[model samples]
Target chain A: MKARVTVTLKTGILDPQGKAIEGALKSLGVAGIASVRQGKVFDIELAGADPAQAEAALKDAADKLLANTVIENYNIEVRS
Target chain B: MKARVTVTLKTGILDPQGKAIEGALKSLGVAGIASVRQGKVFDIELAGADPAQAEAALKDAADKLLANTVIENYNIEVRS
Candidate 1:
């Protein structure tokens, strides 16, 4: 199985890096940009486990390497 | 309007940071024993623009700052 994890900053957090990127975009003659926030994604390959088992494993992965829950939120999707 | 941009390492790109995170996770005893890949996301708020216009702006953002297209790919989602 394969799992895709998306990690995003929590609302209300100050995203300086994202803002910097937005600014850079505007300077590059890329108009219409209003704002920007940032996040992460993880694509993992599992050991051909069942969906439930995969979910459990993925949760473990999230708690460990995928996210810092204090500042970020993560969502996981599993595919065969 | 708001736009979400997810930037991920292209397949076949070596992700040392992701590997390091995986190792850290394992040492933390949070084991699923899987591989890890890392990516980035950007959430943007527009100036009350339509989805189509927002998408154009987002593309510019991605091209300029949100992603290093040499190794990263981005997807944009617009929400009102």
Candidate 2:
């Protein structure tokens, strides 16, 4: 099974890196870009793991280590 | 218009951050895992932009700034 985890900043949180990217894009003349926000993607390969069990484990992993719960939200997707 | 750019390291490139995460997961008792890879995701909002044009611009941005063409590959998705 393969799973993916995406972690993103909460709506109200400030993202300096994203701001920097947006500014860079504008400077580079990539026109019409209004905003840019950055986040993380984690691709995981699991061996001999059931989809449901992997999803549950990944959720736990996200909650415990992959995300800063106070400032970030994480989404997990499992594919067989 | 909204777009997403996902940048990932090339297959042969070394990813210390991902290795560290894998170690941490193992230490934290995350079982049944094979490997872990990490990447970046950017959420972009374009104002009054046509879908095809936005996608092209995004691809340009990814090539010039969002991704290091030598070591990373990026996928751009533009949604209406």
Best by TM-score: 2
- Kindly state the number of residue pairs that clash in model 2: 0
> Per-prediction DockQ scores?
0.68, 0.87
lDDT, candidate 1, equals 0.81
Q: Give the number of the best model, judged by DockQ.
A: 2
Give candidate 1 regions above 4 Å deviation.
none
lDDT of 1 by residue, B1-80 (tens): 87788888888999999899778877887656578788877777888567887788778777777779999888888888
- List the lowest-lDDT window of 10 residues for candidate 1 chain B: B25-34
The residue ranges of model 2 lying beyond 4 angstroms of the native Cα positions read none
- Candidate 2 C-alpha lDDT tens digits along A43-79: 8888766888898788878998999999999999898
Report the Cα interface RMSD of each model, rounded to 1 decimal.
2.0, 0.8
Candidate 1, position A53, lDDT: 85
Model 2, span B1-80: residue lDDT tens: 98889999999999999999999999999887678899999999988668888888898899889999999989998889
